[model samples]
Target: MPVAIRLADWDTDRDAIRSIREAVFVQEQQVPVDLEWDDQEETSQHFLAYRETTPVATGRLTQGGKIGRMAVQKSSRGCGIGARLLQAICERAKEQNFQQVHLHAQQHAEGFYLQAGFEVEGDVFYEAGIPHIKMVRSLI
Candidate 1:
């Protein structure tokens, strides 16, 4: 599959990012509105992945490289979209001089996060009614 990652300021990527987030988090996972939508959005860099000009995945990176709102369209889950989006996120963080990147890993996704070089450093907790754990990766 062909995919390209673009880096843009908040204005350029907001809609695409929100669409994917709503598709995956809201429609698919049922993450509550209060949690799925957050105040941090304005301060994040949204990365939208398009396959042949169609948005297939999206994610966001915060100032300190906190990655969240990572999502792959339902039909695209097993096609490496998430991994590629994550790779883009990490590369963006490195380019921005971030020393570390962190994520709230839904417990079931620990293995996926692990494959991306994230390590769990804390107990599992609840977030938006889903069990999650704090995972971090260092680039420095």
Candidate 2:
């Protein structure tokens, strides 16, 4: 399947991106509802990956250079959709002149970001009942 990824607007792509995040983070990973969704959505730049118009992956970059809410559908796991979403957000951050992009990566998914040039920065911490580690990648 040909994958398409693009910057998403909260007004237009909110439902599509929310669906993907809900499935991966809420239903699958058991992330708490309150923690999974936040007010930051309004201010952050989001990216969505689609397979022929069906959203499969998503990520968001905030004004403070924080990348978060990265999720990929179970069916789309192992494909490059997650990477594509990450790259889209990273490129956007770079274009916006961010010096570094950082994220609290789920411990299991840390390797995925590591492969994309993100380095683990600190000891593991818990977020939304899941173990996470802070990771950072320089856009400079």
Candidate 3:
């Protein structure tokens, strides 16, 4: 079965979204405490997914069409939830008048992002202790 998803509203979702991120990027991935949490989250349209009331994934999108902080719970990996969450975010971007989308994908996820139609645009760089590359796709 496809994973269940829930759209996040910052005012109502900050807790769930933060829990998901803290689990994947901080607790599991060991990303530094300071870097994994950021100020931009307040302004971004964050999406948090729950599987039967358990937070399983989360991501954020900016009004300018950039996607970031996508995380799938370690236990939920291989469920295709990440792709679905991304698709939903892209649709949301279009509904909001965005013409393109951008994300800094972890080096390991470049292929996953590629499968989702994103093309790597620049050299790899380090972010949150992981190697990453910028990826972009047009909404059209």
C-alpha lDDT of residue 123 in model 1: 94
Model 1 scores a C-alpha lDDT of 0.86
Best by TM-score, which number? Answer: 2
In model 3, how large is the Cα lDDT of residue 100?
93
Kindly list the per-residue Cα lDDT of model 2 for residues 36-75, writing each as its tens digit: 8888999999888889978888889998999999888999
Q: What's the TM-score of each model vs. the native?
A: 0.94, 0.97, 0.93
Could you tell me how far off, in angstroms, the CA of residue 65 lies in candidate 1 after the best superposition? 2.1
Q: Model 3, 1-140: lDDT tens per residue? A: 45677677888888888888888888988999899877787788888777776888999997667899999988888988899999999988988888899999989899999999999998999987799999999898
The stretch of ten residues in a row with the least summed lDDT in candidate 2 is 79-88
**Span of ten consecutive residues with least summed lDDT in model 3:** 1-10
Candidate-wise lDDT, in order: 0.86, 0.91, 0.87
Candidates sorted by TM-score, best first = 2, 1, 3
Task: Using lDDT, give the best candidate's number.
Answer: 2
Q: Is candidate 2 or candidate 3 better by TM-score?
A: 2
lDDT per residue as tens, model 1, 1-140 = 78877765577767787788888898889987778877888888888888988888888898767998888899888888899889999988998899999999889999999999999988999998999999999988
